[model samples]
Target chain A: MSEASKSARPDGSNRPAVQLRSAVALLGSFPALAGVDLDVHHNDVALLQGPNGAGKTTLLRLCAGLIGPSSGTAMVLGQDVGSANGRRRVRRSVGLMGHSTALYDDLTVEQNVQFWAAASKAESETVVPALDRTGLAGRLQTVKVSALSAGQRRRTALAVLLCRRPSLWLLDEPHAGLDKDGRELVNGLVLEAKDAGATILIASHDLDWATSVATRRIDVVGGRVVEGTVVEDAVVKGTVVKDADA
Target chain B: MLSDARLIAAKDLRIEASSRVLLTQVLPFGLMVLLLFGFGISPDRQVLGEVPRRSVLEQVSPGLFWITVLFAALLGLGRSFSIEAADGNLDGLRLGGLDPAGIFLGKAAAVIVQLAVLEVIVGVGAILLFGVSLANVGLLAVTIVGATVAIGCAGTLYATLAAGQRVRETLVPLLVLPVLAPVLLGATQATEAALFGPVSDGWPWAGLLGAFALLYIAIGIVAFGSFLEES
Candidate 1:
């Protein structure tokens, strides 16, 4: 972790990593997040499970500071994500892996990872280790991303996230398009990140695999967080309440 | 911010180097436009009111050159944002924590570099095909720099606005062309003054170009983040 992120924590260390109260977000006229009240504590591996268009991705995006809430409050990493300036301030400390891998087709796997790491102001030395950890070392690192398979692209994105070493990770369908080994790698990485004191929010449909690593499961239905369950052997305890509107 | 801008610019340039889309496609398209203009305008015909018996093509070369550049720049701008739009790379940049102003400047810088190269190639093509001689190289150089910056800033801003649209390829030119009229006029008039004589006449137009560039750059830096989010 960087000194800047370490210093970004609020005066008290007891603050929740992600706190949303009646938060709502819109995509055009449609409300993707009608009203969501969720709290995820530090070092928690929380899984968000939902059907398509149930606002799982929207909730993740809001936490990542990619989308500001239309109403109510969203605090992530001690920063208010409802305001533009707040979103900008919190963005560096958070990492997101969305539906797209976000890799440049023309750039080599190494170049893509390096560009993102530099953008995040990460240490240059982390780049190679990230590549090796994601199994994109040597000749694969030099190959253009356009030539890579879907699984390779996901691995490259994972390498990018690893290099940043962000405090908060928002992953949407992280296991998609990955082989069995890749899936295990992702689960291992999530566990490693949790052990390293990073908070994670994963939105995935692969429940069997996701549940294995998740400490808590939150169901998102109709743009609201509906039900919560504590996974077996959970470390951190938190509450997930349904929104007032739901 | 400057360091981030440099990183983005270098990344973009590296992508261009690997893709070679500008070299293989857009550059040839620009040269082709100049060639078409050359064929369209009659070489033997003299301007009715000119003193030195200049041909119609030479008299109109400056305007034709700027027009070609404007058309070609649309393609460049489209390519710039299209790359970002593809696979949600723009979102990646935003989430990466790079300052929005830095992204704007970096993208504008990349566009300027590419446009500068296109301008040089098309400028030489215009000179050779239209039989125009350079008289005031300094004024022409200043005009090119200012005009290119103006185009780069405005083009990058508008391109961001149109990015991620289903009709982005068709929408960009519609949004950008009308905004670039002043650049076309300023650059053409300045070039005419540079090529035809009376070098003092071009400085004011060049100043206009510089002002336009500065205004658009400031606006782009302030507004690019919002536009990026919306797109």
Candidate 2:
């Protein structure tokens, strides 16, 4: 078994993680999500794709407990994420990273992570593991976010995400501003988190990584989702994932 | 449920603490307004001295206090939401599980803090400028506190409602002043009675101000959640 598969069950057991049912969003009071349904079982990485203004962010936010769907309901770990209690349960168990770093520029990287940790009321002891997991060990002690390069700032923000290792990770455009090494490191972290029973839902336009990484893929356009068959095309260095394939 | 309120309020309070000093400085301007009352009420010292200082304050302070408070509160109300809205921070905060009323309380609290500090400065300035002594200082202080609370809640609610409009600055006072006239009349009258006459003299007006504040709090809580839909 790969090291990641072994870590999937720290004690050696498999279990499903997240499920969504008939989730729908309306733009112009019409279905944007279009009665979408999905599942991300334990260790399953899902890629969500969409054209511009296609309810991609809306779907992510709805799952993140940041928004409520107009009609259909959603469930994370068998709990409805839209209800008050369910939203709290989901927020505590999920870490969401988006285009915005959500970091305070003036605070040091460590201070920024700690403040978010404190705000979320996360355990103090978990801070270092979170920082180390994001590969920010060297920068943890010092370095203001504004002082860091674009990629480094994303790492710091990712470190903030690690402060609370949510069971479900929803990332919107997590690959932006990443160099080759940074992207690989982030992909590894996502894969590793999945192995640890953290189901991953990543939205991206770059189908190569999404296909290479995710077990399932969903496509959205104009707030409507269309399912595409997985295609495997070999690339020089990595897999060439083709979703537009007929 | 109030935890929702506290969590949202804490965010705005942290931001508002930085501006409390600047907001309070407007009291000097309010004091100038009070000093202007001296000129209007009595052009010459002979006429002013004929009436006892306490009587002169009782007759003039009510109108002057409201005018000064209205102008000073305009400065604070202008700030309440447009500051947060400038950078899309308001939507960010809403995304973080904060309730709308929580935002309302935080904005109102910032206004209240400013009013309290300004009241102290204006109170002292009013005394210095008009030669009016506060015989019942404790009661007068209470009245100042009440009036400011009325202004803060009333002002914040209006500011938020107008925040998205193109002419929000103009819209805020226009919406607030008409609805809040009773609060002004009550609070200013209460202040006059407290500063110059017996505490009993101000109870009716104080009661009126108290009711106004409560009404604003109630209305703000119920209506704030629907702000984005309307805006």
lDDT of 1 by residue, B1-231 (tens): 788789988998999999998899889999999999989999999999889889999999999999999999999999999999999898888888888889999999999999999999999899899999988989999999999999999999999989989899999999999999989999999999999978899999989999999999999989988888778
lDDT of 1 by residue, A119-233 (tens): 9899999999899888899899999999999999999999999999989988899999998878878887887787678888999999877877788789999999998776756
Q: Write the per-residue lDDT of candidate 2 for residues A1-246, one digit (tens) a residue.
A: 222222333444443455556777665576757676654555556778877778777777777766556667787755686575676556666778877676655457776676566556567786777677666666444776657887887787677666667777888888888886667656777766764668778898866666667666778776656673332221123433222110
- Indicate the residue-level lDDT of A57 in model 1: 93
Number of the predicted model whose lDDT against the real structure is largest: 1
Best by TM-score: 1
Q: Tell me the alpha-carbon RMSD of every candidate.
A: 6.0, 6.9
The interface root-mean-square deviation of each model, in the order shown, is 0.7, 4.6
Question: What TM-score against the true chain A does chain A of each candidate get?
Answer: 0.90, 0.79
Q: How far in Å is the alpha carbon of B113 misplaced in model 2? A: 3.2
lDDT of 1: 0.89
